[model samples]
Target: MTQESATVDPPGDELFARVPTEVSVYEVSPRDGLQNESTLISLEGKRRLINALVAAGLRRIEVTSFVSPKWVPQLADAEELARVLRAPEGITFSALCPNARGLERALSAGLSEIAVFLSASEAHNKANINKTIADTLAVFSEIVPPAREAGLLVRAYVSTVWGCPYEGAVDPARVVKIAEKLLDLGCYQISLGDTIGVGNPRQTREIVRRFLDVMPPERFALHMHDTRGTALANVLTALEMGVRDFDASVGGVGGCPYAPGAAGNLATEDLVFMLQSMGISTGIDLDKLIEAGNVAEQVIGRALPGKVHKAGPFRLRRSPTRAS
Candidate 1:
């Protein structure tokens, strides 16, 4: 729909307009969502959750990260998980890699699509990957080309684009510069991450607007955390600005290992529900998406933070109890 047509509201219309019907939600609960959980999920459980996500009509499932087991013990089974997960047809399974070694392990485990991550804020970058922002980009120079040479589709992540937990109030210009470098290094898509959930609609709009000036929104993905409970709202802002791709976690199952007390990524169930309710086509079954959230919750042995995970999908009301 045209932007003007989309903005037109009849009397008593809902506040948030329905998303355009073509947006795609990429589920990352199995990988980004679970990586920072203090609770370790068993190998079989991870596999089952990923399989369930695929069954729920999610085509893009980030499988796991190939980081050092010593660093991220929760994902110690990365290679094994990658080796054993059933690759259903028409599904794209991706793994996150930090450097050449990580990419090497991912490639050996048969990942054709891989993601490398860096932060737009220097302090958060050093805290996250223990390197300067420039040094990290230099590492990508070594990591991205070889992955591309091996026929791997390389996706890059730029974290702390909105605000950093340590550094705080990151400049949009800094985020834009880092993003351009990643794009220049041949990243197919740059996942813009709000690392600590500090972004509001205004900040989100500003960052996305500046970035879109240099790169098409199609080559970008928004990875938001609900730390301040603004993830979905930030998502709405990006959507209004014509961003169509987003990163969400089933049941909101992730946090930064470095950013303490930070919430996980935006919940996939919530995002899908919002999209579907707006008549936007996500190509996912809301019921099945909740099932995937349940699977993640069950594996983690706790209650999920997603609202839909507790209240369930919206449905037509039944008549009041008549069994008196």
Candidate 2:
């Protein structure tokens, strides 16, 4: 895709004037993508997926999670993935750590970055992590400080910000408060998750507006699932609102194992195709990203939901248009 493929004239161009020149993409395929997979990807296959993502020029990657294997059996090999995956110097590898034990495991595995998460809806929080929103915050008090003191990069996740499967509409004010608490506890960034993919662009923009009132846009990242097929539209709204950080999974492999009826995440190749076509640099090699998506398909033993990977990155080579 190229700028010449699409054009906007005069007043039309004003609508997109706020779009950023470049955005940092936080790759979450290894952790979020694989955790929802029922097939147990071999240790070697996990290594291949991580290497493939790095090969596609992804700088920040979530390698694995330290949650109990009983809950997410697919990621039981978190320690092994951390130990064996030797990413390049500039690459940032992170993992999801649910509690003190998870953090300790990440520390022992020599991971330099880790993430903590809790839901915005009270019911969903209990279902996902077996804790109330208040209890989860208490646990974060225990997790974030020591991790920060040890010089580790800490990120936080606020799930179900847009809508919850159990409780439907969640209060945006509560979401903002959770983000504030995470920031006070030393989290460098917070990824806001639409865990069940029920968000629309209008709601997304309004929710983001409320968040930007109290926090810097750069401190937030959008993690959208495509269950309702509106993830891209919501992401566009976020971009227009001055957000530059995004979370994506290659081949669209993801779902909250706890959130019934949840779908995969926004596809990495699809996202890159949109961003790069708009002349917003993501610093990713799109062709290699498609190949990485293929690696994911192979690891999962089936086709995934990402479109660009299957369709290839090229648009139809149309002949020059003729005016009748």
Candidate 3:
């Protein structure tokens, strides 16, 4: 046969025609997932969770946050945790730094990758960090540079990008402007968050498209909550738009402490299952991920919101033979 006739199409070409070959799954369950829990998890429990996530093939993990214990007591052991946690090779560990103090703590703890956060809506910003958007940016301006000078990779999260509980409706233009400031402030990547989980597929598409017009897809990531059950749909929309990075909590174990009535995040297992079934690679093991979810559920002492964790992965079976 001729060379042209000998060539064969790859598997799942139709399913993944519009999807990227590989996507980055940034696991945030260690920090965002447990920040609002009422129960105080011991330092050892937290360490076990992080180690479990690492063993499950997650390369990037947000291990903890450096906020004041008064604000988020769940992560009070941030410094201690950071100091004791072992950073194996090939794994990129990150923590959230809210201000100069948090950055100082993270740097002292020997963390190389840190994340900063600000909200797009003024009302949400005021509620979350007790500052206006401009004030938060000013704080970030001071925080980002020195952190970069310290040879640290800085990532910024813009919360309430879709809608705010206090403000009701947020303007996407304002979000874009805030993102530009973050990029200008030297944030390596910007994760747009639907802090209250009010985004639909249409809104996700529009906001992502506008952002892509100004910045490359590689510079952006989606941190979606499943409050309205649209998180997975939003992920699909972003994937179609060539966006590859996503933030998910294992076992759907997170909620915004500032945004009232917001639900947990899109479960990492569910996202991985959808991606793998479509032939897109996430470098995560589904069974091990489920085990991690179980750990989270046990630690939190409640059933998680992830569908796959409760119902298990979908399977196909053969039909029975006729009795006659």
Considering every candidate listed, which one attains the maximal lDDT? 2
TM-score of each: 0.92, 0.93, 0.92
Q: Model 1: clashing residue pairs? A: 254-264
Off by over 4 Å in 2: 1-10, 315-324
lDDT of 1: 0.86
Worst 10 residues of 2 by lDDT: 6-15
Each prediction's whole-model lDDT (CA): 0.86, 0.91, 0.90
Candidate ranking (TM-score, best to worst) = 2, 3, 1
Give per-residue CA lDDT, model 3, range 144-172, as digits (tens): 99999999999999999989888788888
Count of backbone collisions within predicted model 2: 0
Candidate order by decreasing lDDT: 2, 3, 1
All-Cα superposition RMSD per candidate? 4.8, 4.7, 5.5
On the 0 to 100 scale, the lDDT of residue 36 in model 3 is 89
- Give the TM-score comparing model 2 with the true structure, all chains together: 0.93
Write candidate 1's Cα lDDT for 206-246 as tens digits: 98889889887888999989988899899988887778899
Better of 1 and 3 by TM-score: 3
Backbone clash pairs for candidate 3 read: none
